[model samples]
Target: MNTQDAAIPSLDSDLADGAITPIDRPTLHSVVVSRLRDMIIEGVLLPGTRINEGQLGQQLGVSRTPLREALKVLAMEGLVELVPGRGAMVCVLTAKDVRDMLEVLSSLEHLAGTLTCQNASDAQIGAVRTLHDEMLAFYRSGDRLQYFKKNQQIHSALIVLAGNASLAMVHDILQSKMRRIRYLGDQNDDTWSGAVADHEEMIAALEARDGPRLSAALVDHLTRTWDRVKDAI
Candidate 1:
């Protein structure tokens, strides 16, 4: 071997036996998508408003390419409509639309609750507990955005813990589309407190591994969610 080649260390052992876990960091495109999702959910980008790509690109400090890509992602998530020549527009969900999706979601979550209570490992339940604690902290601090994010995470975790990939896939699609409407469900102090209380019951049921109780809690929560947001719609 050449002298320089001999001096260089081999990575064969490290490649085969490395113990370091890979970090899962969000990509720039995903970050942009998340910001746009938050804006829509919080009503900053009102429904039916045309997305000004250039303006948003500048505001977000990203070039048009990534911004457009992010918009395409949002379109797929049903949060935006892509018009032929008019660009993207924020999607408007009618009361019927919200009701229909929530009904379906309630059913899906009902199944998930029972399955999760039966199937989730202790560590999986602990992970959800951690998310719940963080969500409570955000609620206490009056950080609505962070609280909502954690709230969504907890629901997603429940579906995931059920161990049904097909159910999870369908649930995710509906959940993504309903995010903006769902965010409005707890807009006031009274409704917010009610929603938080509902979550407390859910967590208690989950920790106790009571499938029937968790299923009932999930259904009740989604049913009340309609009442909370229907007036706004």
Candidate 2:
């Protein structure tokens, strides 16, 4: 063989026989969509990157049918853009989108906390307290992921305590949009400490059942969080 030809290695000889195993194919469209969504949120798929169906399907060990369905769901969530001839691309979030989402979420969360102060059940308050304790534990352990889950529980519990279906639905959707950003913020050392303190303060207000105080605190907390991320987002 020529020197150039000898320099190239063949794939079949790169490893022991059967060194690699194929991944399991996804059975449901939602599962496929969720896997892709996770990759996008976790930074595996960066913003504005084109998704090649054939290549992505091969990478994911999925067929075009399932990959297409997954792309459709991502498009609905504003995470993927559908181009007429180019297929899907990861969405690039703009400042405007961030601002609008912050406004909506802040208002709804503030209102939800206010209503919770007035109408929350004893059991609901207890549940929130439990979640608060869990968050404290997670924080102490430096497990930001667990802390994040507890944070969601606390927020969702407050919304449920509000007893407004429409408001809860709105808050839930807003939460979905901002979760990844919030998670990253919580992982930062300085941000995490301050965030823990804010949670404690909010819990105290909830325990006191003070609607106005809770409402104001909720608004301020959410606003500050968004402010921290404003420049980057």
Candidate 3:
């Protein structure tokens, strides 16, 4: 067998060894997409790097079909570029791209803040506050990943509370592209502290049901977030 073929452990062997059980094709496809997405967001597939389909497929123990489909989904999410002749490359965001996305995201968060104030149930707001507190705990414990995950949950909860599916959809699309950059920003002590403080303001605004204050705070928070990452872009 070729080196590449030898390198790929058989799925059947995994099942025989009780390492993994059989799963439906759809489930397998979803797993492939998620794995690829995580790799991209974690910078395993570095920005502007050309995608090596053969190596990637072998490493993933997945066929080209599922890998290709995952690439298509990532392309739609603006994480990958499909070059006609050269195949796929990881998308690199320019400074202008970051600014443009942040601009639109700022507007979306502003609208979300307004709607969340007017429409969110007390329970929903409470949930966000709980998440915010949990995120703070993680931050204090120096668990950056868990803190960021909870931070994202707080933001998503606000979007869900906004009662607009279209708005949530657009925000999710833009947010995906910024995930890595935002994670990097969270590594900086000053920026991370500022972000935590911003969340405190957000929770306060929500508790008060102050739509205008929440809206303004979101815009300012997002603007400052961009400021933290702009130099890196």
Candidate 4:
């Protein structure tokens, strides 16, 4: 192997039974849990896909101990379902589950937006606007991945602006559940332009400090987005 090639683990070597280097982070449990969670959300591990503990634990380079604990966390998050003696698999959302989750998410976001409108300082609004502008430029550049990353920033900023710690915590949890479904929905739905427009309107409402208007806009935006993807579920 060349110097560079020798520096990196060979694909075959890394896939070996004992190839996983031990993680040194103190919070290894959460890291393992988060990696598995992202794989599930990104559809790398499809919904209803049976999780092979041995394969997964090996692939992730951890002992089965941490992998099992990670699966347990996912089960609590509703991303994975535990089957007695059968092990865990990604949770499949029925149409009803999708509908219920969408409704709950929309309502909660509406509440958050309303509270943000009431409580956000001018500086917070300015920050969101800056992020929105950056998003617009990134979208114009046709960089969906970059835009998606910034899209996350904008949402998190809004939640922080809400000035409610509990609501922010709730949003983080809900966003994890919605991530996979939202990706599928966004992929099939052609209403991204409308969605962006709605976001602009949301900004306007916030700028105006109109609590009621922001709340209504959030609900309408989430509902419309959900409707577009509901049929696919």
Indicate which candidate wins on lDDT.
1
Could you report the Cα RMSD, in angstroms, for every candidate shown? 3.9, 15.2, 11.5, 10.9
- Number of backbone collisions per candidate: 0, 0, 0, 1
Cα lDDT of model 2 by residue, 1-233, tens digit = 99999997765765555655667886678788878877876667877899989998999888999899889877876678899988899887677877788889888988887899989988889889999998999999988766887888888888989999999988877776666566656747888888888888899999999888888888887877876667556
Could you tell which candidate, 1 or 2, scores higher by lDDT? 1
What lDDT does each candidate get?
Answer: 0.93, 0.82, 0.88, 0.80
Please provide, for model 4 over 133-214, each residue's C-alpha lDDT reduced to its tens digit, 9 standing for 90 to 100: 9988876776655565677677777887888898888877777666677655445325656667878888898899998898
User: Which predicted model would earn the best TM-score?
Assistant: 1
lDDT tens string, model 1, 194-219? 99999999999999999989999999
State the weakest 10-residue window (summed lDDT) of model 4.
Answer: 183-192
Global fold similarity of model 4 (TM-score): 0.73
Per residue, candidate 3 scores C-alpha lDDT tens digits across 1-233 of 99999999998898899999666566877898788877876678889999999899999999899999999999998888999999999999888888899999999999999999999998888888889889999999988877877888888888889999999999999887887677777767889999998989989999999999998888998899887887777
Candidate 2 least-lDDT 10 residues: 13-22
Off by over 4 Å in 4: 1-31, 133-153, 165-172
Q: After superposition, how far is residue 164 of candidate 2 from its true place, in Å?
A: 1.2
User: What local lDDT does model 2 show for residue 233?
Assistant: 64
TM-score-better candidate, 2 vs 4: 2
